[model samples]
Target: MKKFLSALFSLCLVFALVACGSSGGGEASGGESEETFLSIGTGGTGGAWYAIMSAAGAALNSDLNLDVQATGGSIENMKLVTNQSADLGFASPDTAYFAYEGGREFDNANPDLRVVMAGNMMYEYIIVRADSDIHEMEDINGKTVSIGAPGSATDIVGNEVLSSLGVEPAETINLAHSEAATALQEGTVDVMMALSGVPFTAATELSTVEDVRFIPLNQNEIDTVVENNQYWSGGELPAETYEGQNQPIPGINVGSLVIADESASEDDIYNLLNTLLVENHDEWEKGHNLASDFTIEMMETYVENGVVLLPFHPGAEKFFEEQGVTLNK
Candidate 1:
């Protein structure tokens, strides 16, 4: 009787252990379930960021089982990602750096954002009426200028550029790119500073206006501004980007990059980066001219340019590693 009782006890213990193991396996599988949706914060409806992000979002949703939603522009986008309010978003390097360092607009916000990928170099173009006497950057001292909508990255960079050049209180107007172009065409504003990727609709429209001219930022001024702000770089808008505008316009370029929070899972970031860089590259390029700029080589250059302010997520680092590319710390 004692032998039989001991045998029953041992069998019961084995059953309990098997049950616990099965439960643990079930929980592990649940944790590994796929994430199916993501959001991409972009600018106004007609901007380059919006166009590209919208297309990328569609591809991610279809190909990678991700649902990418386009929200407001850069400043708001950074806030979303930093607070974990959104999964993915776009931002300028300047804004990303400021937010990561808790400077400027991000002074009161969290500084734990990380960069996922670099997007493009948006050259700041200052356009004025061709018949107007605004030949140099200083010519718009007291004129009405459309700086850009409030809280937008364009506004932030435009304000800084103007302030750097000692052009204070220049009758700044807060208008979207399209609205600003209309204002310029109708003579409501004398000058407008538009910072965006090439083939921008607003700049292209402003070019078609019979009397508008592209103002060049001198090399000395570009160097001074870049010296003061590490985010600024010197670049030019090719004349071919605009119809009949046959000369390259010298200006300061700001990089647009995709950023996310450090809390995002490695797999999530890996999936996102892989979608943007590899699987969806050709499709993205087909959707917008700006997308043509998205390339692996450019991605490397973006990181090397000091544009990535936050630490790289481990998944992204791994993805780069698998591709045999080393990322700098």
Candidate 2:
């Protein structure tokens, strides 16, 4: 009887152990592992930031759980990150600075915003029909123009450029990038301005079917804009950036940045950088032509040029440190 009872107890212990192992232990079973979940806020669907960020989310899906949301442009993205509704977001240097410092459009300064990395240049492209009599910045005065989506970085900065340069449009329309492109093609608007990366989808599609030209900003005027706005820089789109553009078009450029809330874990952000920039770079390149320009070297240039507007998240700082680059913050 004693032997029987002992054997029964042993069998029960074994089953209990097996149950515990299968029920609650975090060890991978059936090739499934725990995933860290995150969210990213990007620009409108038609913009480069949206495409790039969506590609990044998919590339990191194997390692982490991430959701990408298309929001209004830079200003709205920054707001989302600050409100903790988003884990990270894309914004221009100027918008990030204002959001962090509490000025232009923000109700209060959000000091919690930190940069994960500086991405591509958002070139200010003031596009017009090829045969339009508007040849220079001054000609845009008294003409119908689509600035950008309302309350976007493009709208604020575009207005600043025009206001400073003394070019006032007779009628200003605020529309999404793709909608503005359609309006321009349909001759409903005379000028469309895009603050986007190279090979912008709307601009590319617009150029393919219509004879288009980028209105050039005077270098001196651009210099003045740069001097007054610390985040703005004078940049040019090289000839052939688009099908119909033959000469380099001069305009304003701002650093596009990835920002995060201060509460995010360092390890998670570091792993994200590893996956997007190292492990799945090829897939990222397939996302957009602008992806090729998103590199450690490009970030270094932003740092060197003093365009990085906010402090770096600790995880990103660690990753950049490993690459022999020390960020300003």
Candidate 3:
């Protein structure tokens, strides 16, 4: 029933976007500028993906003569971009890989998908009660857990990490980050897994409200996990992201990328890429702290084991190659 409702919601969003696409004539703020029209689909309205990409779209409108519309987040963005209802979208590279390869939720591969720029998700977190017996990633086995909302970036990665660790709980719950935290406090689930920036609010709130201790992936465990998933890297979650968390939590660093639809002309993609990656990076940083860490070298390193989730649009390829960098699949 929940799956049906979720699919219905997506279809409704796509149908509404189709209407917006047909009405056309969306322009930059003033009537004076005849800009190149484009749309970027991000997550919900208040989240980081939405806020940063909304700012990015706005900046593209004012400076690049591009009329940009910010739509929904990763999943909606994927649907919109694949159908050409939206020109660009943001998604975790791993989830994007799943989408393009027909590996996870996708029924058919999105052949038109292509990656542009990538950014890091600060850490991957697994949390349990302070007094709980689960002290490490392996301890999660046989426990009840909430793996994050169905179809969310966290859910996708959470499942993948569990698979890599060879750990599966006796039961699983699917809820959004906040709801999952609530469920944990209410004793509905025994553990919570999240992939987010440090001091993840929901996890932190749980700490303030409940006596909790984060489960860490020891160095050997990190090695084992990353050995199977190149998209993951061992990292420290930093101390004090939450109360009683005086030591860094061992976790993974993953990349989230901006991808484009093939239906967007090559020139449009090139222009947008150049404007964002080179000319307007500073403007983006003012709004998204993640942008500050985005560099060509980091972009080069994010792709894993020569397997790309989405192919690069010719335009993005051109820009990067001109910079003497080449991305491979």
Top lDDT prediction, candidate number: 2
lDDT, residue 27, model 3: 43
Clashing pairs in 2: none
Q: What TM-score would you give candidate 3 relative to the actual structure? A: 0.76
Tell me the TM-score of each prediction against the true structure. Answer: 0.83, 0.90, 0.76
Model 2 bad stretches (over 4 Å): 1-31
Candidate 1: where are CA atoms >4 Å away? Answer: 1-35, 61-72, 209-211
All models: lDDT?
0.77, 0.85, 0.72
Model 2 has a clash total of 0
Pitting candidate 1 against candidate 2, the one with the higher TM-score is 2
lDDT of 3 by residue, 145-172 (tens): 8876566677777888889888978887
Off by over 4 Å in 3: 1-31, 35-37, 44-48, 55-77, 199-201, 204-211, 303-309
| Predicted candidate 1 versus true structure: per-residue lDDT over 1-329, tens digit per residue | 99999999999999998777656532433355334566667776646787777667665634354444445468888888877778777888877777778768876655567777778778887888788888998888888999887778889888888888887655999888888888988889998777788877777766776557888989888987788878778899887778667889888988888877878778878887788778877777777767767666776787777666677777777887787665777
Better model by lDDT: candidate 1 vs candidate 2:
2
lDDT of 2: 0.85
